[model samples]
Target: MNRRKSREIAMKLLFEISINTNDVSETIENYKENNENFDDVDFAYVENILDGVAKNNEFLNKTIEGNLTNWKLSRISKVNMSILKIAVYEICFQEDIPSKVSANEAVNLAKKYSDDKSPSFINGVIGNIIKLK
Candidate 1:
């Protein structure tokens, strides 16, 4: 799959791991085993996101929390948190991906998986993070 589709899968896996507290590698392997369409999914990118976010969970959370305006980390939904973590991971750790692309993909993910207001909230927070970078 394309990067966008890979991102979606990564976000979903991240969301699942966030709630279940499962082993990221194990969960990814299981996901791949269960899903028939593995040819299109970018497992490398997906693994990068999953591993990157898990490795830098605290830093990512602090970065996101620091960028939020009048919002606490605990108050954020799991889906939004998952999306934010992936984007933050990409923006901070992945040198090849542009920060704006990360931000935009994050907003798109929020729009698809989060509530109505989540898109703008995610955009604003990511925008702030990018500006600070």
Candidate 2:
């Protein structure tokens, strides 16, 4: 499974949802409409993660809040926040994918989308969550 591609889609969908509070299914449908050849494998990942995160948002936010040191989830950048949500979802909910993979992918997303410091900041937060777990 090309989880990185899936993770990328998950993050994109999650970020979009965070912004406008659109329906996940609708947003995904729109996403699919735009991106050609997104394929079933990738779409499944996007749908699963988008659904998973939405299903447990309150709990996931609380878990992320608990792991944050002197910082609230809202304080983080939207880009990093989106990445963190994906990572934390994988960490706290999805057991098929390892925590380390989630953490690494989050850092990569941060490096790709967020400011320079986001990678380390995200790494630290994810590391703390791993330690706590």
Candidate 3:
């Protein structure tokens, strides 16, 4: 599958876990049962992202919460928030990914999965973060 498609699946799984407050194992099992097309690498990426987010949630949330304007982290859509978290994690910890790529991918994910305002909002916040970092 394409990278964007992989990211979308990863984001969706992350959001579902966030909304449902489900464990990673359960989520992975559910995905395995539900998505016939999922492969090992795709599962690996999703697991890595989810684990990274969980491991660094406090720092990630604080970073994201700081960048957002007139909005609290809790107030963001689950989809948008998940997208941001994964991208921000990539920016902060995944040195292999360029910060610009992470930010752009995040904005695209926001546009694809969130409201009309979400893409720009994501871009602005991520831009601010890249600048500050």
Candidate 4:
């Protein structure tokens, strides 16, 4: 599939991992086994995101927390947090992907999976992250 779709799946996987605290590779393997459309997805991209984000979660959280004006990382919804993690991972680690694109995709994911206010909130956080980067 396209990068957008790959990101969507990665976001979902991140959300699952955040909640379940499962082994990343095992979770991804199970997801692949269950998902019929797995063939279309860019597994390389997804795996990179999953492994990178998992490996660097503490740093990512600190970066996100530092960028926040008044909110704690715990205050953010899990779904929004997952979205932010993916975007942040892309911005910080994926040299091929533009920061703006990562931020935009994050806002799109928030709009789809989070509440109405989440899009703007995510946009603001990502904007701050881009500025800091």
Candidate 3 minimal-lDDT segment of 10 residues: 37-46
Off by over 4 Å in 3: 39-41
The candidate maximizing lDDT is 1
RMSD after CA superposition, every candidate:
0.9, 1.4, 1.6, 0.9
What's the TM for model 2?
A: 0.93
Question: Which ranges in model 2 have alpha carbons more than 4 Å from their true place?
Answer: 39-41
Q: State, as a TM-score between 0 and 1, how close model 3 is to the true structure.
A: 0.92
Question: Model 1 off-target regions past 4 Å?
Answer: none
lDDT of 4: 0.92
Query: Clashing pairs in model 4?
Result: 1-40
Cα lDDT tens digits, model 2, 1-133, are 6778878888988889889899989999888788776553477778888888889888877887888888987788877878988898899888998999999999999999889989999999999898988
**lDDT-based ranking:** 1, 4, 3, 2
Point out the worst 10-residue segment of candidate 2 by lDDT. 36-45
Model 2 error, position 106 (Å):
0.5
Candidate 3 deviation (Cα RMSD): 1.6
* Alpha-carbon lDDT of model 1: 0.93
| lDDT measured at residue 25 in model 1 versus the true structure, 0 to 100 | 89
lDDT of each: 0.93, 0.86, 0.86, 0.92
